[model samples]
Target: MGIKSSLSKVFASFVLKKIESWKFNAVDAQERTLQKLIAEAKNTVFGADHHFHDIKNYQDFKERVPIRDYEDLRPYIERVVEGEPDILWKNKPQYFAKTSGTTSGVKYIPISKESMPEHIKAARNALLTYIHETGNAKFVDGKMIFLQGSPVLTEKHGIKIGRLSGIVAHLVPAYLQKNRMPSYETNCIEDWEQKVEAIVGETLHEDMRLISGIPPWVQMYFDKLSEKSGGKTIKDIFKNFELFVYGGVNFEPYRAKIEASIGKKIAAIETYPASEGFIAYQDSQTEKGLLLLADAGMFYEFVPADEYYNDKPTRLSLGEVEIDKNYALILNTNAGLWGYSIGDTVKFISLNPYKIMVTGRIKHFISAFGEHVIGEEVEHALLSVANEEGVEITEFTVAPQVNPAESELPYHEWFVEFSKAPQDLAAFSLKVDLALQQKNIYYFDLIEGNILQPLKIRTLAKDAFVNYMKAQGKLGGQNKVPRLSNDRKIAEGLKDYIK
Candidate 1:
């Protein structure tokens, strides 16, 4: 091993020990985190308003602070935007992570000095854990690229404002600076297409090993490499490439297509990151779920997904969560977001060390006929059938078709983009329908009672989702089409691309 590789192994060993110490004591770590957050923020404006000083336990917190989404916290955020101090956290935030919201036009999520390092540390430890487990530290010496938004920042009242990924770009550690790829100028390209092209030009022949990004954008980079290299697989172009790290979406649906592009199966890591916090990361290659970051300067609360909209939902702390149950994730972070709803739903797969799988968004589901099928269910249903039928799907989305032609019953419409179409589309559709019925009992009852017809599939033309997102000005950079929608907005928009 080279000098860097040797140093990496030693560092990984050290970090893994520290991780083990916390992982085994997850509940205690979480309790300590809550106490620390409460003690530190009690002097802030929100703390006083919410009676944080009197909070002594989880029950007190639940009664004192109400759950708040971005809209509910907008007044405080607005004041902070106008250069106010100590409105949320102890002092002014170091940066504001700008993100596009569905109802709220734009959101500015604070990144306090205390919270910023946690993001970097969690990401670092994820890789370190991999190294310690698999003895694979050589990738550290090769060039790495993270497909992301423009790193260019705009100033809002002295706070740097940019995408979460872009803000993270500014914080890449000094040790990895030389090994990181697609020069700063290339990363600053506002247009994603041009950015990918530039990235391909910069790293096409370099010793690239680690490629990290949300899957679709990484797929775009792979496509560009294939085009430039005259259809050669990624393995052929970058012989040293080994690890694929992804976040923001589940990797299973895209797994077949991505591995096909690479021409081989490779080691991969999944992470759960958001503008609010870095919640979890896959700690073991053999493990089923991402290990929750219980001590990462944040405390978590989980409300049962079914009861999320109710007046008084049951909020459970880490020790209270159970395996295989879906919950809407809530956060109280050092960044000064208390009882904040980030809108993502997750399920605990392992509670021994608190591991979870991101199930879907709280708002992204189809329940027109009371089925309430989520993102995980739809993806699972399709993937199970696709694997059996040897089909390769590029992308897909589900929406409730509440109305149909005369004499026809309403059904769920699945818009699918296929790289490899199945031999028998009808038979394939039936299999997928059966799989979904098995996963969701309500949907099965609806079909059996003749309240709705079997779901229908609409094959989309090649690059259909890409074109749709492009038209919406959300072509890349953390933007993704919802896997499931209650309304026909996306389904209607996708009609033009139907084959």
Candidate 2:
């Protein structure tokens, strides 16, 4: 093993001790983290207003600060952006991580130096924990290709503004940068297609042992490599490849295709990372859910998913949570975001180990006709059909057709881009419809009562979603197709390219 690999192994051994300790006592750890954050920021503008100094416990904290989304905290964020001091954090924010916004064009999230270590540490410990459990640290001896946004950051109000990946790229440790793939010039290419093509060229011959990216973009690179090299699989080009570390989106839908591209089975790691914070990661190979980082520099609160959209929601702490109940996550982070709704919904799969599976997003749902359908339900139904039919899905989205212009009732429209189209498309559609109906009673009722027409399917041409996203200037990285929309906006937008 190389010197770096040997040292990393030694460090991983040390971090394993910490992770094991934190895993079992998640509730206590989370309480302590919350206390620490309250104490540290007690004198800040927000803290003073919320009476943070007087807060003695989680109950006190909840009562003092109201749970808020980005819109609620926009005034404070604007102050910080205007170069105000001690607005949210103790110190001025050094950077802002730009991310996708719902109504707004872009969201600029504050990133302080104090909170940066948590992002770095959580990622490092996740890998170490994986190695500790699986005993698979050999990949550390070779190169790691991190497919991220351009490293060149854009500046706004004298603060660096860029995608989280790009910000993370600038923070890559010197030791690891030597082993990282793709030159700086290649990563700076703004167009995703051009950048990925250049990345394929630069890293195709390197001794790449580990690869990390959002699954769809990684799949694109894999396809490009296969086409250019005339090889059956990615393994043929990069023989030393061992691990695929992925985040941002679900990996199950892309798993079969990824494995097929590699031409062999390889170990994988999943991380729950977002612009708000690095929440959890897969800690053990045998574990079903990613272990939540309870002590990782953020205070967490949960509101039952159904109640999240209500005027006043019930907030529950880590100790108050139960397994299998979907909850929308609320975070108060070290980075100055107080009572921030991160918008993610999750369900605890393992209470003993404090592990969770991300279920969906709060804003991303379809409830056009009281048949509320979530991202998780959609994903599960699609995966179920894909598995049963022995086919692979490339991508898919669902939008409600609320009006029937012709001779039918309003119903859901499914636009699917299939990597391997099932031999019988109608049969596949029927299975999907049935699976969805079985999962959601309201949807089933709508179908049974004939108030809604049968779900319609439109098999999209190849790269249909990709072309759509590119046209919107959101082709890659953290950008993703909204899986479910309540209106016909997304469905009608995709109609032009429907086959």
Candidate 3:
């Protein structure tokens, strides 16, 4: 192995030692982490305002700080954006990772110096953890492509503003930067179609062994690579390609297409990184869910998903989390976010290791008729129907059709973009409706009682989702279709693109 590979091995070995131990006592690790965070920020304006010094433990901290959403914290974030120091964090934030969340239009999340290292380390360990668990390090010896947003940053107020991906590009270690593909200039190309072509031109002949990005964008890269290489599979062109590092959206919907594009089955790693903080990663090769970071300079709280919309929901710490129950995630991180609801819903599959699978988003759900269908249920239903019917659905969105003028009874409306359309479209729609009915009893009751009509499904033209996202100017990098919406907004918007 080369010097860089050798160094990586050493670091992985050292970090894995702690990870192994922490899995046995994640509660203790979480407690210690919370204490450390409180101690570190005790003197900051937010800390003092919340009486952080008076807090002794988790209970005290929780009692002092009420759970807050982005809207509740907007005043503080605005202050920080105006170049205010020590307003929320101990120091002035170096950058703001801008993201358009489902509920919030454009959010400027602070990225502090203290939080930056934590983000970087968690991401590094995610890859290293995969390597340690699987003993697959060859990808490190060759070039890797990280399909992120532009590395070019724009100054906002006094701090730099850019997509989280772009901000992270500059933080990648210099050694790996040497082997990273797609020139910096090409990455900054505003038009995604133009950028993909630029990437294809530059990396067509390079030794690309690893690729990382959100699944949709990476699939675009894989498609471009295949097109440029004259129908050769990615494996055929980059003979050494091994690992696909992906997150930002669930990979199930695109798995068939991605595997088909790659021309072979390859190992995939999932991460739970957000503009708020680096939360979790897949640490075990065989395990089902991501292992939540216990000592990662962040404190976590879980509000039961069902109670999330309530005026006063029950919030629990790491020790109180239960297996199989969906909870809306709340984070108190080193980035100066205190009791911030990041809007993500998760379900823990393993308590010992604190492994969780992201279930959905708080704002992204369909409960117009009290069916309360979530992203997790929609994803599960989609997977079941896809597997049973042997179809490939690239992207999909669901919204409630509640207008009596349009339909006799209220029903769910589904708009699907299929790369490989099913031959029997009616049968496919029936299967989707049946799967959702089976998964959600309330939905089933609504249909059985004739209170709501059967779910409506419409297949969209290929690239319909791409076109829709492009029209919204959010076609790439962490932007994804919100699986469920309360009204017919998404479905109505997509109607114009129906085939």
Candidate 4:
């Protein structure tokens, strides 16, 4: 059933008023204010036998139990997956999300009905906050295009379900939703090629106003739309949209192409979401970096970037978190997940607890030769080169490789497909290399002797990695290509193609 727009709008208005009342309330208390709520969710959803007897505060709770991760609740999750009734947790997952994080390999994460409220509420709060701040949501009448997974899971009979993008498609407030290409309902295509075709078929229509998804997928979607119309842009297809919201990974690479395709100064909203929980988001023009959903029904902990690998880590509340420093966020959410490290890193952009900017992923880094390089550093460096060269290459990936043939020189290789090109490779590569060095002092020292040189930029046809991920049976959903990697295997394997 389609969501009633009037009713949803009324509810949204009410929700927005309440969120505005928060006023950075996430830092009002040193202890979690929603401990009772999280406890209630835990006992009701997980069927927990034990209850908090004496703990009166966050510190007490911290002392009583250690933090946790996904593996910690294998027993409960296993039961939920098997569809066991009357389990401690209440929400049965509609479907498991396909995510391959640092620890979770080829993993299927259950999205419980109970846990989803937190995700939805937090996301709503962020979106509303954006509206309140920008005063421009009315531009499209609250009709949004979210590039999320389809609700249908691809299963036997080869029935094609919406990928993670499809799931989000179903989850949005209905009037904002569309029957865009590759309807998760009927797209029996699982192969990326097939799925892309299916989505392309639907996207060719002119009704798709406002789009959201990982930048690559959105880029691919636009490329398909353009191809279908023989050089027409998204502006020609869904010319009505005035805003574009995207997160998951950096969208800077494709920012130019996206703007050109849309033919306007598209309002870009960046969000920070993880499998464990949706941590922070920023769409509000008044604020920079995403505001951590600090006041959500969750207890939070912050581990300084340098101390993430510490033997005995010290955790802090939002108030205690420092500004401009990176931290590995820890959360004790309503889902009964505690001390769960969501893996995404962030920077505090403001004093308000909710303000943060996603720095990068914890696992996706290039440090093969002890020269630690991450997403933001590489992205900024590339942007600088692009600016210098006056080119727009939005799609690129970086991998660390030691070329044995080149006397085992540890070099950073970049595979970049450009909408525009820099004036010179030699100068651009040196500038990128210096930028990386200046960003990471350690990298600077390592490259001082020319032991490791600058970056390599190579082009690819628009849907190159899209086709690659599709070939691996990973094309249809939340899955995305890693932006940076330390693994020599992935580096060497994708190297030839980078050239």
Candidate 5:
């Protein structure tokens, strides 16, 4: 191993020990974080308006702050964007993470100086934790590539504004600077397709070991590499490539196809990151869930997913969360977000160290006929069946086909892009439907009551999703198709690409 790799193992060991010290006291660490956040921003406008001075405990906070989405918090965010100081948090925010919002259009999530380090630290710790557990720091000596947005930033009222990944690109640790791939000039390319092409050209022969991105984009790069290299597997192109780091979407759906592209099983780490905060990461290769970052500069609250739309949903602290129940995640961050609902639903699988799995989006579900099916359920159902049948799915989405052609029973329409089609598609669909019914009782009841028929799969053309996203001008960089939708907007758009 090189000097850098040898020293990285030492640093990884130290970081792992520090993480171990606090992970066991997760609940207490969360309490301390809440207290510190309140103390630091007490005099700020939002803090004062929300009675932060009078806040004494989690109860006080629950009573004072109401759960809000981006639309609800737009007024305060507008003030900040218009150069208002101390409106949300103490002083001015260093940057705004610009993201596309469904209802609010453009969302500018503040990234305060105090909170910025948390994002960097959590990401670093994820890798370090891997190295500490596996005793594999040799990847640090090889080229690493993170498929991401351009590092270019725009100014909104003197605060830098850009995508979270783009902003993070500017903050790559100095130690990894030399090992990071896809030259800065190539990284700055605006178009994603062009960027990938440029990246392929630059890193094709490099000693790449660590590759990170949302799954689909990485797949795109791999596809291009394969095409350029006369159908060679990714493992052939980069023999040293060992780790795959991914987030933003469930990796299960793409796992088979991605592994096929790589030509082998490889070490992978899952992460749960968002514009709001770095929430969790896979702490152990053997563990089932991502470890919630309890000591990160954020306090978490959970409202049971079923109760999320209710006027008075039960807002529970970290300590109150139960295993296996889906909860709408709420955040109170040092970045000045108070009781902010990032619209994600998560299920706690482990409580000892507080590990969770991203279940779905609160807004992203299919319930046209009152059979509320979530992202996780659909992904689980399809992936389960796919694995059993040895099938490879490229991408898929589910929407209720409430208005099927005359006299046909209503059913869920599954738009699936398959890399390897099942010989018995009807059988495959039946297995998937059965799996989904087992997971959701409502869906089972609906099917049994003749209210809904078994889901029908509509095979999509090659690169259908990519084309759909490209047509919508959201081809890359953290954008993903919703796994389930109540309405047929996406389902309709996908019709053009049907086989």
Candidate 6:
């Protein structure tokens, strides 16, 4: 390690000691335990039996290894393509988490025995972080609703298996397990398409307190709740649900609408999670960014946002990264991924190496009209206007569409499900325009005052995301709308809903 990196570790140790002095926390001991675990992590990934054993330090590692996404593992995937068994991280791997992700085609990420701890550590510490920060033991007593995939058996793998949804479910303490609600699939829907239909139906009688998962799927449940209760909002069904923790998308876009329908500002929190690991989570719902689980069994490396796709992408270790700078992360974990480039981008929100705000995915950007548009700028612009207007939104998606019919301007449409209707639609639209114009100089210069079009926000008809999921055949498992889609296919799909 370099002098600066060494200095960062010393500072981290010192400050954490101070934090451990707080009345409710006991993490200083956990920090010492983590030091031992890190040594084990290095040994496991770099030991004689595994791959990439050469590098002893971060600087000695290659400046840029040939980048590969999940598709690059096709050769390894071919080994077990016919259910041949004993593939990556074998030992009769308990079960595979069937995550529904595709751009080119369907991707089945195999979560094996060795990789199991990665998810477990992530989920366990997620709660530990919440307790350390909030001092709330209510989570130990009350019902926690997991807005996630099914907990059913897998015939394909032929294992008495676990889903990603319930793998984390099995790791929690037995005390907390007693209070959990059975999955929506177990109680309500067996017909697959109707799984969402059942999960929402089963949640009707439960007193949900701390709910977790993506924003869109939760919205799908709330929409169903509204319909089943004769247009009554979800608050009507689960009257005592005070904590509303959501993530996996930009929460700011739908903040106003969700709040409006729910009758109060649901204590919300954001998280950054993946099949690889639960990377980061919010310690307090009121905090600005997620308090990253730094000591979790993963070594994180970040490549700057501007530098990600380059031949020599810059990589920063935990101690080397700075606040407010955007970086694409590389991973080395207990999960057997080394120097792995996970595709998400995050901006550090504070001096603490463990806290960050996920700004956007590095893949989700639009430059169709010579105006480069990214998720962070769009989120900032929308949040500025929404905060100003005092709007409460629960679900929304954004896109950049060139107006084929209208020659004057390229249109940026924000399809929103709103809590309140603004009396002056034009005024609200203009506010969104001003927020955008101030943030992007390319956009500002391209269309000065008159030429630039204002944003269009439209309220969904209760079950809009549900309708989208049904149309896309993504009604079950891990299906969520891309919070920002810059493609024409989705734009055409939303044309009727956009006003």
The estimated TM-scores of all candidates read 0.99, 0.97, 0.97, 0.85, 0.99, 0.79
Q: Write the per-residue lDDT of candidate 3 for residues 1-499, one digit (tens) a residue.
A: 7777777777899999978888778899889989988888898888899999999998899889999999899988999998888888887898999887666778999998888898899989998888777777888889888888888888966799998889998889887888887888998897898988998898888888889988988888888888887899988998888999999899999999999998899999999999899999988778799999988878899999999889889989999999999999999988889999998999999998789999999889998988899998988887888888788888899998878565499888889888888888888778888898998999999999998988877889878888898988878767787888897777778998899
lDDT of each: 0.93, 0.87, 0.88, 0.64, 0.94, 0.61
- For candidate 2, list the clashing residue pairs, or say none: none
- The global Cα lDDT (0 to 1) of model 6 is 0.61
**Better structure of 1 and 2 per TM-score:** 1
After superposition, the stretches of candidate 2 with alpha carbons farther than 4 Å from their true spots are 155-158
Higher-scoring candidate on TM-score, 5 or 6: 5
Over 4 Å off in model 1, which ranges? none
For 145-254, candidate 4 gives per-residue lDDT tens digits of 45455455554222222344444545654444443434554344445455666667755653554566778777776777787888986776676666676777777777
The Cα error of candidate 1 at residue 254, in Å, is: 0.2
Clash count of each predicted structure: 0, 0, 0, 26, 0, 13
> What is the C-alpha lDDT profile of model 6 across 45-104, one tens digit per residue?
133333234544556444323445666655544444346553443333455555545552
Q: Model 5, residue 197: what's the lDDT?
A: 93
- Model 4, position 112, has a per-residue lDDT of 52
> Candidate 2 vs candidate 3: which has greater TM-score?
2
How much does candidate 3 score in TM-score? Answer: 0.97
Ranking by lDDT: 5, 1, 3, 2, 4, 6
lDDT tens per residue, model 5, 1-499: 8999899899998998899988999999999999999999999999989999999999999999999999999999999999899999998999999999977899999999998999999999999999989999889999999999888999978899999998999998998998997788998898889999999999898999999999999999999999999999999999999999999999989999999999999999999989889999999998799999999999999999999999999999999999999999999999999999999999999999899999999999999888889999999999998888889999999999999999889999999999999999899999999999999999999999998889999999999999999999999888998998999999999999999
The true-structure Cα RMSD of candidate 1 reads 0.7
Clashing pairs in 1: none
Which one wins by lDDT: 1 or 4? Answer: 1
Off by over 4 Å in 6: 1-51, 80-94, 112-114, 155-163, 170-172, 183-193, 226-239, 392-394, 417-419, 449-462
lDDT of 1 by residue, 75-119 (tens): 999998887889999889999999999889999999999999999
